[model samples]
Target: MTPPPLAADTHPPTELARVEFTALTGERVERIAPISQGWGHLSWTVRTTSGRYLIKTGIRRPQQADLYRQVAAQQIAAGSGVATPIVVAVGTPDGPLQRPCYVQTWIEGADAASVLPRLGPQENDRYASALGRQVAAVHRIPGPRFAEDCAATTTYPTWQAACLSRIGRLAASIEEKAVLPPAVLYAVADRLKTLTDQLGNGIVPRLTHRDLYLPNTLITGEPAGAALLDWEAAAFYDPVWDFVKLGMWVFEPHPALRAPFMAGYTEFEPLPDGFHERLTLYQGIEYLAAFPYFGSAWPDERMLASFRTLLSGWMDAHGLVGARP
Candidate 1:
């Protein structure tokens, strides 16, 4: 007998995922429910008779290769003893959903973003340290080439070139959105270009979880260990980019995590030279990008306002708010 289709509201055809899961594991699916949905992806927590699993799929047709890359990165991290989810199956959905999807072992944990604020100082530091070590391990693995996406085959000759290209794209995006005034936008573009030029060449691209942040980290275990989630944004790029992301998304917000995290990272690898300068440039780019990147859906108005204030102070600190290119 044909099973009743999964809920219509569960986008990307959770029914297909259920069928695929059953076929793969020979386990009867008992229940499935959407757990998270955003950024063009929908995730469902599926409970089988024996266990639970996570099925993540995009709302639109996904690049099959990209899905593979995501799984590959996750597997690599897992192999390195990092606590990433184990992949069970991945492929294009053979249904109306059309998007690529993957099923993996479900982890019972709270998002570090929500959990960190409530933790005691010692516990927070421990999780932060664990996260740092995990990040360092990921960086130890080399990538295919210098590109933003793990699945990207394109290569850039120099780190500066790759960085400038990315900055250009961000500038163009913000300009298109008209998030900032024309004068301010032009100056900011020039400042970014100047900063990008300062980044020298011969940097090797390393595997990086480009979206590492408290929200993307899952804290599990009795004492609460940290595990990375969401490998969709993994990439081959300067490791400094990951540091910049962590600085903005983690350290800046939760200042206490900074010292322990940095300490843990240095356990495997010392902080890269010129790290602070690179961080400043990258932070400026990210702060500006946040406007269009988060859009109206930004959950925290206070945070958004903080970014504006931060951006203004950043430009002033660099003494380039209206400086020429």
Candidate 2:
């Protein structure tokens, strides 16, 4: 996968972050160190008299409300028995600090991506299974009766309808950008319409951690479990979409990892019929939908080429070559 461009650090300086941290938590910061793995947020591991905590700020303005919402989502996930970090305190958007921020208890494990490759076959499977079960647990949370609008003011009758509507908007955005070639854009439009027709309605909606790839999970020993991080992208949507993302980003590329995750998830909920076809449809939509955002973030030739290559491969695999609206 092409790496996302590193967002410039718009966060306050460490001393300033420390001052705000002290003001919010009422404890002096003993140490502050940056966490380098993330791309979108500026975060630091902060040690204080109370405990070790994570201090995170958005890389851009207008992120305060979103940060607050993310904290709420993490609380919901934790309440559902998922091993997520607890939110300690949150700074208001209009406060003197101006930047919205939050403090959460620090988790103590390396990301799964870093640890998975070092483990033996048995250990890897064990980790994957644990991760799968946690994902299933999150999916068990009941979704809202009404679909959530992007602007947070309206609702749709069904999750599928809401998703199709969103994809339609995304299709228009991508076409306007013209980042993708005409052939690819035409193929994407054809697939989107077909998926909308075939997917239909009345599927039960569930809480989906839309960004639950390998790096977003932390692996630990002894207890042998995974702690999911980054609840910012959590939403109410089709649970199958999460499985498709996991298969594409986590399991499929690494053959040895596939069976264990499936074994764990199937233990909780069985895969529905026509799973592969649905998975293909969702994957295609994801690639196309992602193009606009990723293209805007990283506009260099190499990144665009990488995206084109991925889209071309998906088209070939799905027999979508020469497919046009």
TM-score, each model? Answer: 0.84, 0.87
- Against the true structure, candidate 2 reaches a TM-score of 0.87
Off-target runs (Cα >4 Å) in candidate 1 are 1-16, 24-26, 37-40, 59-66, 96-98, 222-224, 295-304, 323-325
lDDT of 2 at 287: 73
Q: What is the lDDT of residue 89 in candidate 1?
A: 75
Best by TM-score: 2
lDDT, candidate 1, equals 0.75
Which structure among the candidates has the greatest lDDT? 1
Worst 10 residues of 1 by lDDT: 1-10
Q: Write the per-residue lDDT of candidate 2 for residues 209-295, one digit (tens) a residue.
A: 878788889986546477888877666677777876686678766778888888887889777676676677777777776678777
